[model samples]
Target chain A: MKPTFRASMAWLHTWSGLVIGWLLLAITLAGTLSVFRPEISSWMRPELHGRLTDADTATQAAIGWLTAHAAHAPAWYLEAPSPRTPFTYAVWEDGTSYAQHALDPKTGAPDVLRDTLGGEFFFRFHFELQLPYPWGRLIAAVAALALVLILLTGIVAHKRIFLDFFTFRPGKGQRSWLDAHNLLGVVALPFHLMIAFTGAITLANMIMPWGLTTLYKQDFSALTHDFSPATIEREASGKPGSLTAFGPLLADVRHHFAPNGLARITVTNPSDSNAVITFNAIPSVSGVGVENHTLSYDGITGKLLAEHRETRPVMGFYRFLYGLHVAYFAPYVTRWLYFLSGLSLAALICTGLQLWTSKRCHRQQGLGFKLVERLNIGMMMGTPTAFAGYFIANRVLPPFLANRAQMEVRAVFCIWAAILLFAMVRRPNAAWRETLAISSLTCLIISLIGGIPHSPIEWAVSLVSLGIAVLMRYAMRYTPYRKKQS
Target chain B: MLLPLSFIGLLAVCLLAAATPRQASELFTPPLPHKQQILIRAFGFLLLAASFFVGSLSHNAGRLLIAHIGLLGLYAAIISLGCTLCLHNKKRRDPAKRRNNHT
Candidate 1:
């Protein structure tokens, strides 16, 4: 590319990266943490650790609980305990919405664990940006699209990327920042591309609803049917028939689907004679763990009704993308890699933002320059502090408080807001130092108070906090964001 | 164990590739010879490619391979950042000490 063309591309890359870098950091960090959703859930509910049982046993327990409580309900849902997540949950229709509870595997009683969103909050925020439905997702999709453009522009802009790959100049202010940005962007080029594209693909339907209409010939019901699990329906015979012991039926299904296990069970008209139960098989960890591959049976007679396994040619591709987005199929080792990649994303953005700020440090003292710097400090440092705060709130919050689960979520956002407000008032460099220090202290407190070295994850998180503190200290010592008057 | 082994091996390969020097210099550090750098990088790439094939035979199949590929890149970036940061801190202080002696 010509120098002029490359410089234009550079302008695009820099501007694009800076415009919404804060939001991207938040989204990416939340996303990366969500990879360990089940593990976090396990940590949050300490009571569920190591108490998981076989799918058949948990299914039976869930069935027994639902039978007693919601016999008259139209439908019942059971999530059998899996190897990954250790809770069996049952849900029944309550008025218009659903009432749900996680059941202890051993006794099948309602789980005494404190109510929390656990890993799911991060998952939702990844695409939703924590805003109400549609708008948050729409903005996320737009951001994903912009990220793809920025990546392309960045590649076009960096003419000597090969040389830059081999270079890292430490103490040279702007040069160091540029080299760091190029290094991070180039190293994870493939991951950055794949994550951006697959992320956009995830909201394919919402992005272009007309495309689904075209595929399904405007039959929304048909589209839903094609995507939904297989089911069998039976009319009520006006005779009440008790639910058969779910354990044997579940065992038989497990044996039939051995190696691949059960994920969910849905019982329709549980007290009626014509009741039907559907068993959905769980895909392997490295496979797309969607609620497909269903085996239906008569609730009254325990007779096998029908079965449908996922076998479509297109499904493999869809599952691949789904699996990539969810990281559902990864082993723990690979999962940590995803988490590290996420932290790198945060680092990448941090370096880019710092580079932008450093470039102007010697010349400009505009409101815009200060505004962007404040945002970077607010989000990059503030978000981590908020995450640590979330864990601490989970630990300290009383279980009996009204809507305590909501309160825990509120604590996370409240801290996030508080940090941003604090960032606005303080000097940007000091804000970076202070917020990172706070994050480090918060993480240390959580680790020690929760009994550090007790669990590998807890220890790992604590170390990350300490690492951030040390990193920020080095950053403060070497960079352009010193307290000199402009 | 196979997955982690392959993962660590891949990261080691990335670090080895990144160790090749960037600029030509006389004093402290010199770029590795071209022949050795190319040979080492080729070997690293081959091993990284081999992991996918071996992973399919392992229980997890192809899923672990793709994740490892992304992770290897991340590890490379972190290592690069760490090396540069260490240099920045050391060089920054060393120059200050030398200048102080002269002054």
Candidate 2:
């Protein structure tokens, strides 16, 4: 077979990656952090620092917290804490609304929790970019497809793939960068491919639920009933009843399901004749957000009523995929491995772009190179600048401000956009150095501010940032370029 | 034969690496043609060292340490070999260039 198709693919890969390298970098980095998000969030909140609670205590607290928070609600949802976390979060639907709150780790009492808007915001942005409903997801999905093509072409373009596997010569400017890119890309091929494909699949229902939509056309009720369970009608009962004895139902759930990493519990149609307490098992796999079972309990008598367990072959397959992708239930070794590899993938994308632009320094000091330079400016430094801004907003913004979380994101984008504009006007070499220094300094200062009430860890991180800034300044000043010999 | 295949391939990559003079034409410009051997070896070493920390944390220190260190050493050796090839190739190519241009 003529390698022309491969050559075209190579071209496609190069251009495709160059086109969306920044976006992919952001996604990969954020996704890597997302694996340890809960842990990071816990550390950020100094209030939750020393207190460690058992599962039973946390669970009880969750139950009480949900009941109090959603007293007048028709249904309640409790997200139980795992071994890693000390507190459980509870949410419930009231009249045309849903409210959520954290439960105390020690007593299962309703506790005001430290805001984790930063962690959650970053996590969501990784996947959805926090754009309007489906738009962010759609853009991300397209980027992921582009990424797959890039990887395939990249592999093919490097004819001596295995030969170049261990090649890395320092002081050889662009050559070293290429080696880094190839090494990372090849070594973590499985991870890179899986992350992109699975990330796309995460939004599959939104993108191509055509089969589900078509097969279950307009018979939405019947369709849901076919796979899941038919919703039984429940009439409200005026008599007040004690929800004290939910223990037996909980026991029943554990016994039947083998304690399936249950994250949340929901009691629907409360105060009704057919009040059903559905204990949803935490999602294990690709359905990271979706739960597996719906174990119903007679809300009044506390008796196990019905169960809709998704243990079938088809459901199991999805669960496995989701489980693998999330890496939550996986052993610690696997999760950390995934995190390191994901970081490498992010580094690969950035190094690849840097290598591309650096190689063409003299060839095209023209419009095209200028455009790439601006993009590199925006991508390479803009992201970290935006991230620093996000941290800044978290510390400076008034807690009572309306939609403060969203504002943090806006701050990030605003800073990122500003840097991109600066890159357009500034010289490429100057821009690279200035932006890195600025980003590092910004991160350092913002982290200091955020760390004031927190701990030394944030300050330590700031020192590292400042150190990076200084190092970048040195490199930018010292690194020399050879004049072209035509 | 395998060693020679590996050696030749590594040398080709190293020559390709050595050719990136920062002023090279875009058409023949090496992709990500920056420091080829040293950086790869450094990163490979760091990754292996990092795995040691991770392995120790997870109590899989013995097995993982051996595996990671072995892999790191192998890559480091290859990178060292690549460096030698790069130097040798540069010597050969530079002399040929001087002769052709009569410089």
Candidate 3:
């Protein structure tokens, strides 16, 4: 006999959500934090330079510093901040190797800046979890697809959906928990769907570029050309060549975009006379987190050749979608609201997982119930342990260590993996309480140690993060466990 | 599961009342009395419709006025249908007949 449509959808929703719930929870929560990553970084580095610096002076100083450091470098990648961020950061590659540093605002000196890891680490962790490039990202992308399916099935299977919205009847056992879950889910449904869809689309080319592959055919170079028009170089010859100078190029960009600042610069086909120089124009719109443009110049003559602005109909729409999803362009109020909603969504997933385990435990299911109980603990508590490890790595690890980012990320995964493995061996409740307590204490103590150098404001942020960590541990201690019937 | 599911169900009902204002489902679900069902549905519908009208009217006076009118009409239709359901339930079980059934 065929099951009813609702029954079929219910099964789909339950299984789909459960299978990828932890992954989705991690990705979404990390992504929410990443939306405010830049601000957090700024807050973390209070001992750095002041809030503002002159752009022209900083650029010239950085170029001069790079010339002195690596005079015969093949290429220099200069990344100057927009108005929002007033620091000069750059990297350069010579024939042998590449190096990166933040410029001192006053002295314009390199290597003076502290080696404190900033928001970029969080940004990288959000998508890749610091895993090996495309593979980790691929796993996350698959999880996103599963999330989309779960949300769709959830909506379809929800009965009396309207009656459920304002119906948080506490202390009604499963009914109360379900009501809270549904309320949170529906309240943030638009955000959840939008973020998942847009996040998938952000790496659209990586996931499915069939359309591009078909259109561009074997001339795949044209795709890069079309997207990054600024990357075009002069036709090559059998003759050797070398780039002239970047001074005039910088001057030209300054004249063209007077009020708006220059965000970044790219040198294509460097060490060739016919190399291309691209000066990315600063966006005029304030608070829209993205900053990229294409203004190509002749590398030999340093003449402004052409400008390809993508902030138009189709591309603009894509940017808008990304902006909405990331909340990069949002004000303080909207960003906090987004953060709160993301926390609520995490709570919803946690409670739902608990509800499933509780029901199964009551039936005296042996190994299966134990496995679920352990997984719930490992996922919920283990994630915080991993996050604390990341902070610890940043503080203790040598700043000049090669591949520091990767190492910090490895520390997180190792801790998380160990906890998961331990959960499998140990009793669920004992491991849960211990891991939660350890993670909370680690975070709190680290915050105090790492935040002492900064001002009261930074201390407060650290305190808040630490407080949340402790609260989570407390919640774990109170969670009910299975009883043995006499 | 039961707790979260029912909350979601109630929320959906309230939102539907707000969004459509005129569409009411005919099925007698949730094991509630006919009169109580009609009253709750009508109240939800009218309240949502009114809030929508007032909010839009105050925010974007010119265009929202038209929106409010349309919403008001929708509320009227839904409330009427809900009232019909109440009457049908009453007809199904007369008070005198109820006494006989009990006896």
Candidate 4:
């Protein structure tokens, strides 16, 4: 119990990281997968499983569809398809309830994706921990900040972190674990630093809102209105106005973008005479920076009225950081890099948890140690298997059932709960082997289950699952259960 | 195409790092003099990093910087695993030689 700096930091790193490490694993895995949110959404909806469409035409088609079907909505947001995303994604409010669906650009028909959340579940889960709104975001902020603290303390505690970055001595139990932990932690140091900071800063608005709160008297609406792009504003005319052709408007906006073109087109009060069409531009390049430019047009006349440009550097900085976190700028190859780094993060967290017992206490029957071991197996193995169950549920669930999406979400938790119970009751070693084997099987067979389309996305995902299976299989050999038998 | 090329360059760089006297000695390879090894390693790293810009600026540059760094880290991990496997194989076949070399 010496009160030395490194010792204090070591103690701090262990406890803080342990308590929040589960949360970190959950978020990191989901956040990594969230890199391909659009692709995942596309894959989940088999109805839209076809060749890609032209962006301009897709925008027009989406507009046409929304004009007819989404007229009841106060406004409609339509994102034109891209290389990675297959369709025109649309979102709008339906009498206080919100609705979002992906539409085929050619047909303007929404695909039959079971009301499942798909990748959005992961994306939202990343920042909000899937909790309700502000509270989820608050918890995410605390978790991210804790990660930042653990990383900083870890850097301080390890003297040879940089020198040992290349060292890895396997087959030496505790030594191997330490080396693996240090190597992964140090090699991905910059990434861990940037991701943790950016994640927290992205929620800085929620965590530290005093500045904005003071300026706008807690009216976030007013604060956003000032910086927001100008849009056409009008009271309801009570008379309906037919929308003009969206093709020319989309073409007009194409000139503004290089390589890539219009991203989203929104229609406000589509049925009213004062209806307006807002064309939002996306960056052509596959990297990060805010490209949320807005060009508002009179819906009836199809004439451009207002243009909103980026003028604030503060907002630009935040968007850059946000873009880094979400990785919307990454192409497919780069996306894999993000996913791999994210897995490294999860590995680091997992190793840290293992070291808590492996390096410290013995294999005692103490309740705390047993509980931690059970929780570790339950989370590390159970979470991924739960996702496998989710994907399977998305395929098997009756598409027409009411609250189908809710059922899909429930499937994840149900599978997770069942596995947790199993992990608690069974020996930890046996639990690990059984859960991983089930995960491997689920991932190995999802696409083979008839009706699910086998796209390149599915293939990429399958390769990852295969990698997980191999790792888990190798891990099964390391369990002390077999060692005891021998 | 660019991704694979980058990966190859990275693998070659890792192999070169393992070829260096300090690293080679640890991996059961003959230890050469340290002369110019540092320079060679730096040059190798530079060549690998330069590959990022060779094909398309948009492919690996700009917003993809984090992804670029992540890939490098992953390559490092793979290299570490490879080195560990090499050491393990050497130890299994001739434990006396490994002990003598270390001593």
DockQ of every model listed? 0.44, 0.06, 0.04, 0.45
Q: Please give, for residues A1-486, the per-residue lDDT of candidate 1 as tens digits.
A: 535988888898899999978888888888988988776766777666567787567667767867887788888887777766677767789778776667777667764666777776788888997788899998898888877888899889888875556467766677878887888788877777878888887776667778777788877667655765468655677789899778789888888777778888889989999899988877664464454478889998899988877777687677677767777667676677777777776778888888888888777578998888788788877888898788888889875466776788899999999999999999776777787778777766666656645566666655665676566555555533555543
Q: Given candidate 1, what's the lDDT at residue A223?
A: 69
lDDT of 4 at A439: 75
- Per-residue lDDT over A145-219 for candidate 3, one digit per residue giving the tens place of the 0 to 100 score: 777777788788887765544335444556756766776667666666766777777766667768888899878
For A1-486, candidate 2 gives per-residue lDDT tens digits of 346877776677777888889889888777876776665555444456556577666676666655555556777767667765557766666577655555567656543444445365667888788788789988888887778778878877877765564455566667777777777776667677777776766666766778887887777767766666723335557665547465566666667666466666766656555566666676543233246677767777877677786767876666556655666654455556666677678778988887777778857478887798779777778876777677667667764466554576788889988998998888766677788778767756754664453444455446545665565566565334332323
Model 3's CAPRI class is incorrect
**What CA RMSD would you report for each candidate?**
4.0, 9.0, 9.6, 3.7
Across A1-486, the per-residue lDDT of candidate 4 in tens digits comes to 748999999889989988999888888888877888887776676655564577666766777777777786778887777766757778899887888777766867665444667788888888887678899999999888999999999998887753465788876667877898898898788789888999999888788988887889967557655766555656668898888877777777776555656677778888888888877677536547656577888989988888877668887887778777777677677777777788889899988887776764445458888898889888988888887787788878887678887898899889989988999999877787888777777776664553343678777666666677677777766756324433
Winner on lDDT between 1 and 2 is 1
TM-scores, in order shown? Answer: 0.86, 0.73, 0.75, 0.89
Which candidate order results from sorting by lDDT in descending order?
A: 4, 1, 2, 3
Model 1 pairs whose backbones collide: A285-A329, A286-A329
Which candidate number has the best lDDT?
4
Clashes of each: 2, 23, 24, 0
Show model 4 residue runs off by greater than 4 Å: A50-53, A111-113, A232-237, A284-287, A361-365, A450-454, A481-486, B1-25, B29-67, B96-103
Better of 2 and 4 by TM-score: 4
